[model samples]
Target: MKNYLRLLTHVLLISWCACNPCTRVESVDISAGVLLENGSVIYDGLEYPKSTWYEELADELVKRYGCPCIGRVCMWKCCGPGQTPFNGSCLDTGLAEVNPFNPPVYRGREPSNITAYGTFFYMHGHPCIDSYLVDTADVNEELFIQENGTLMEVAIGGTQWHLPTGYCVDMKYHNNSVAPRLVAAVCFPEENVSTDDSPLLYIAYAVGLLLSVPFLLATFLVYAMIPELRNLHGMCLMAYCAGLIVAFPFLAYLKLHVGRIGVAMTGCLVVAFIVYYAFQTSFFWLNVMCFDIWRTFSGYRGGSTNKRRDNKRFCLYAIYAWGVPAILTACTAGMQFSDNLPSHIVVPGFGSRRCWFVNWLSEFVYFFTPVLFLVVSNVIFFSVTAHRIRSIRQETAILKGAESSRSDKLKKDKQRYALYLKLFMVMGVNWTVELISFAVGGSNWYWIVVDISNIALGVVIFFIFVWKKKVRGLVQKRFRHMLGMPPVATDSRTGRWTTSSAPTEDTRISADETAIRLKDMH
Candidate 1:
């Protein structure tokens, strides 16, 4: 009962921190102007309070500009106390105290209403719209227009006011200084900006994915063909590589067709499921590998007399790695398919591009939480492996008399650590970059580095495991034999083909044994 309780606690902790549910888009036509309900325009189906900045801005603009503002949405900017006029604004409220944040009103018109505020504000921060209509008639009435008894400016687009109250404004020409050209002044929230526009960024990501596939494919082939590489560790690696093969292409499709993928359509849901399952399975495989290493170093083993124990262990790992993700993804999908999700839980690209979960709750529950748990587990595994290596070295030194034995042990240790270090770089660095990118809110260079690093995993694994001096030689000989070539001269004692510079068969066999032993412990 105590053991079961402990196990339950651990399971609950991991699930609480790492479970991320799936998502799908809401059904709404965002392009249609928000409906004026009561005194406020309903934005994304949420009714704003009657007197909020967004409502006031939209209402005022519609009242003055008529149908032009009725069908279009506007961008809002706002400022709080002590914040500089041009430099800062309320990101959440979109209300400004002085100048709007990055107004899109072009000032290059011949009849410039280049007021002190507009000119200075433009100099500091110039976010220009295609064109704006100006109401020069109100120039003499007051420098600022009045809305619900508040003082504000109503700048129009070239064609009429693209920039004003609560960051959006309605236009009426008081001076007859300019024609009362109608314009849209309703502010809607900005769509998410994608860096996929940059050619270099696109190429880097595409190339990374492209480069990864072949190497991973090669890894799968080599592992399947070589009996020496068919241990549990290699099997996990192959599974991870397989996941990447499916995942990268799907990711590319997502980025390229971001706009087309939204709402819980049959096609969208199917593709999303595959992508999620592959990614989660890969992550689980990584965790399994880490656990295997830790168990090996910690000296846990099943009895050899229990012939099915190793097979059972492998089956359990297979089930855990594949099953958990399947369940989580299925549950999330089922909830979404039933159309029973909270409105606050926004599906990413719901009204824009790319189908994904965006709300913080969903992100934490579905994606980041699992990633965080895996990262922590990997760290613990590395620490245990390091300690075990050190302890084994010390013990072997005390027990063995021959200098050659110590040398052989040291060589094996160095090789193992070298490979492990590569493993850490492949897994650890990519995840670290992911965490940092999230923390820093998508810095350009950070994401670029991450894309490149993630794609390099397969290449790193292939080089470390398949392209090694010994492994490469063995594979070449094996291929030659398969191709009906004369057998390479072999070492009489160990029977493995040997090159002059390659390590002796005995040393190689010992290293192979060590690797397989560690894998078996998984």
Candidate 2:
């Protein structure tokens, strides 16, 4: 039922995206006078085009949305207090009024086309526009002259384009007007990103992190309380997942709110370090699980009988994986914190801002390292499956001409397959959650995605274990007896296997014989 509901939800979201087209407005940041439309915040103020044609706009949209990439669908982050969708309203948590954003449509450098998009630093929903498009224009250099700002004029046969700092204009597709692509990005300084107020991205991250707690607690309980899971390799991986959940909240909080909360300035990065390594550890644990399955199922459990997992090695590796990312991030942060990164590397919509990945470089590596691991691990999963099939064939051959009972093999195959199923389910959930939110046009999407994925994974063990037919049948029988129902014939209406009318001793002996024969034959 849960799977069916998720499938249905995904289909509905895809259909909705097909039906709704986004609206865009020419939003001007008076402080920068940069134009935002499509996804690019036009940064080359001197290069603003006079006319916007379909071809130019199409190209920009593709780049802005990072289209053709089939992974996660993230939002076009805005300079708002809460990582609000990019409709241009800015929300400031504690600072004075936020950046000014005014939507624009041009009446030819005329003052008539400029409309205030919004000024207050509070979220007011996404702006209604697919971004902006403009046609041929002119530049009144004197129109927005302020020290370094200048306007330029360019010609394309009969038309001229003008760009003014504070002026507004609109353009549409015209066969006669064509211009090269203009792109830029929206960004705050690295200092601001690590500031005490915690910008929108950090806040968005914080919310997602904070919600990870329950899953983390659930995970610890799975290991700490459940005796069956204590040494089981699969459960160990689940434990790692639990560990990842715990780290997400802590790392994100440090990255997002540590400074704001008046914690140690350096502690932010330290927590971030732990977070990075923790994720790597989790991914590595997942890889270990695949290997364990291949080894155990293939009956190649060759390790010495008394040998157990090395707690010391586990701790050391965890430190190294995390320490490496921290060191990498720290070096990068030093460069970034010192106004490093190449200037020629320009990202559209960023305008003139000159940093990338910001201060939470650790977080980026933390989140994204899994993608690489996921790909490689998935390949290993298939390889392991293929190898197991080959082993089964060989083992059956060794038994030469004897009819090999396949039930045991089939059961093992299922256990192997379940791991694959769980990983695929997790990925699918992330994609569906992300894709739907993108179509619906909201940045609150991340919060929902993170929370749902964590909770769902923790709950999966229950359904997969408790809902299987044989397992559930036993549970039902026990429950029926507990409820004072006399053991009688099988409940045919519910199709439950009925207990025999024989005595308990006879039943026990029969069960033991069946078990022995089944084991020999299997």
Candidate 3:
């Protein structure tokens, strides 16, 4: 009885399985259109069977194919033979088909009675309009050739053509015969013709930038090697110098090699990014110095005595100096790569057009704005600090018995302030000139001279910070200590150099103590 029941149960299960077979989902190639899982069809890369409105279709066509809709049909922007689409228009390859006997003619117009015909090809050396036919005579002066060789009509007597003077016209043979058929038109500007700096100027600029690297490196080395110069101020200077050291070489490299490498290359993008980040960090570090000096003079008690406290303060400075620029750079990178952003929104455009900001507007918005803010803040800080210094000098001048000591302290303060002032002038003036030169829009000799002078910023920094009597003494002491020689003695009270006849062992001070003393003196 149990066996009969088991067999009956198996038969019922088989019947149920036969009644409900599984359905497998498989990908099928559709000839008419691509079918989505949601039952939407993509016909010719556009949504199909959804909108019949011409306006809607036009928008879809523009979004999907970047082509215009004409007469209720999508008119694709086609590149001619030996031409490739770039940016928005066709870029001519050197191998463009040329037929002097058969010139471009207006579409839908007879060849003999055509008002517009090619007088000569305008060869501007630009890929977009190279070998494009120049319109000598047009019945309607408003009619001009576009960059893709299409005939376009503008407003009567409009000056828009002056903006991008060059125009392109692509030709096709009618019925495979010698008769030419004009297909498309393109218009591009000659703005870059006079804007390009002379090759000699570029070479000089690159050379100037390269020349500063060694001086900047030397400045960094001096700060890094000397234990006494490893304080917050010295460390800031070192960081600033290091930023310039990295930036200058890369900038020079870009100036020299960007043309050969091409803006689209990965290496060009990487180098451009490095240069941007380095310069930004340098600016931030310089701001840090200015703020630090101001804080010191404002009677701020933090980061003064304790080593731990100083380190903590420096960590905070590093975070601000490095972190802000990192965030900015990341934002730039994101914008450069993002496709979701609207056309109106400005993007960094790095590596797309060139290895820098795409246009002056983007450059000003992304780079110059932040730099300007920092510079303004620095100016305010310096102003306040200067006022404070004057007040302190007046107060100290009232002391008669300790006049010499007070004078010496005031002199030291002035010297320190002077160093920062010189540094500020070096960077500030250089950038100011750069902004002016960029705005001027041409290779003016006066600005070129200023640019050459700006290139010596590293040398200026070296002289201002490292070529001093005090620094020389510190360098000498550091070298002696490294060589295991007798260290120089200084008067403890006045902190001035002194000759000592004492034995090296008895007169020797710990490096830490010397560093601390140097820190206190500053």
Q: List clash counts for every candidate, in order.
A: 34, 43, 16
Off by over 4 Å in 1: 1-200, 260-263, 300-309, 342-353, 359-361, 399-418, 489-522
Model 2, C-alpha of 323: deviation from truth (Å):
7.0
Per-model TM-score versus the true fold: 0.56, 0.40, 0.64
Ranking by lDDT: 3, 1, 2
Residue 440 Cα positional deviation in candidate 2, in Å, after optimal superposition: 14
RMSD, one per candidate, in order: 22.0, 18.8, 22.9
* Backbone clash pairs in model 1 (N, Cα, C under 3 Å; residues 3+ apart or in different chains), count: 34
Sort by TM-score, best first.
3, 1, 2
lDDT of 2 by residue, 166-237 (tens): 122211112223331111121223322323232665566566556655645554554454322343443544
The deviation in Å at residue 167 for candidate 1 is 16
Q: What is the lDDT of every predicted structure here?
A: 0.51, 0.39, 0.60
Clashes of 2: 43
The candidate maximizing lDDT is: 3
Give me the overall lDDT of model 3: 0.60
Of 1 and 3, the candidate ahead on TM-score is 3
User: Which model scores highest in TM-score?
Assistant: 3
